[model samples]
Target: MQLSETGRGVLVSGASRGLGRAVARAFAANGDRVAVHYGTRADEARATLASLEGSGHVLVGGDLADPGDAARVVDEAAEALGEAGGGSGIDVLVNNAAVNLPHPLAETPYEEWAALWQRHVSVNLLATANLSHLVARRLIDRGAAGRIVNIGSRGAFRGEPDHPAYGATKAAVHALGQSLAVSLGPHGIGVASVAPGFFATERVASRLTGAEGDAIRAQSPFGRVADPAEIAAAVLWLASPAAEWASGTILDLNGASYLRS
Candidate 1:
């Protein structure tokens, strides 16, 4: 049975774990069909798909590092949802997958740095752009508007002491979201961003310095890191009807940790 005559499709990159899984689950909970994409970890991806709250979800497997593979992933995702029983086109597109390269400037190699840039830019920037274009075309053809949510990081602006490449790339993501908001708004599509502070993900939990991490914790007015669900909550709102008027805005989900206060 078709989820809908136009099965509201959502393509979530990196849906296997962490913040991506949280975002995927949120979309599923709201009855929007989702395509779970994962690279290298098919088992984990399958587990996530199995745990989703809604039905009509499909698992898409591929590595985003390859240009051909990247293009295929989005096409497959959009197609999977359509096969589930819809043709109205993708209603929501969440660009939640990004690479975080944290090596210091001098310590990293020239080629290493270049590769990091290429990987991050290709996955974080180019692939996302391609998907946006495809979805926008589909949405415009169907004469229906949609939503795109780009997950960003505080490191985008904070200019952290290390990870120069990651900082700069995320900064680009911020710009991309804004530009899409402007270009797509007139076409009936909405683009927004979720700039999350240090969430209590395994990545952050493993990096916490005994004293330094504690200090970062104290820095937050809440004295703790944000839960992934909190970030997911912001995403759910942005994709829902309540957030239609909230285009081009980056909802800060950090616990005031990096606030200027």
Candidate 2:
């Protein structure tokens, strides 16, 4: 039940950008060796690794949307962590990679729908499951305790009409976390998902820029968008030992907007 992550290892998916990068850097600063998983942005991943707080954090690029690639990335993380001063398995697995294609359901093309659905399922669900399976195996093999943190969206409950697939996929992720928590609890592995609302991420900010971003911020109860670090703070807690008993729970980090409104 250590509060800090010293002498530990973590694997963070989608570390090339956004929330994943923030989570990875948080773990690195706290005392864990990190495996930076990037889907396409190798340079960004490498740069993130370079800027981390500790040595032994490594950048490993892979498109986790592919079934094979998902397992491969976890295996690589395990291997890298083993070589990085700890003779143990990775302590944390973060599933933070996702994509959303906004389209009205009525006008959405079948191909477009399928593509977006596939991306959401493959990357957000399949890949996360694959890595969790690998990490869970490694944890059992080493007889070490571990954690799984899935990055979900407020859409899980908010139910965005234009982002139906994204919302549905996240709702599915919530179900997956519950199942994983019950299934993996016997092996000392905890599973959970953290859903965020109205975070001012670069990708999101870019999309909802100008008046759109302002409106989004205003819609929230707090009347302001969340700082990325705020999201990272929640992740840091979930991965920390203090939260080991908490599993199968979807923590909603909204500013009471989603709940009260």
Please report the candidate that would top TM-score against the real structure. 2
Q: What's the alpha carbon RMSD for model 1? A: 3.1
Each prediction's total of clashing residue pairs, residues at least 3 apart in sequence or on different chains, is 2, 0
Worst 10 residues of 2 by lDDT: 1-10
Measured by lDDT, the strongest candidate is 2
* Tens-digit per-residue lDDT, 78-190, candidate 1: 77787335564467888877777666777877888778778878777776777777777777776777888888888787785577766776778788889999998887788
Model 2 CA lDDT for position 86: 58
Tens digit per residue, CA lDDT, model 2, 73-106 = 8878888888345566578888888877786679
Clashes of 2: 0
| Clash count, candidate 1 | 2
Q: Looking at candidate 1, what is the lDDT of residue 161?
A: 59
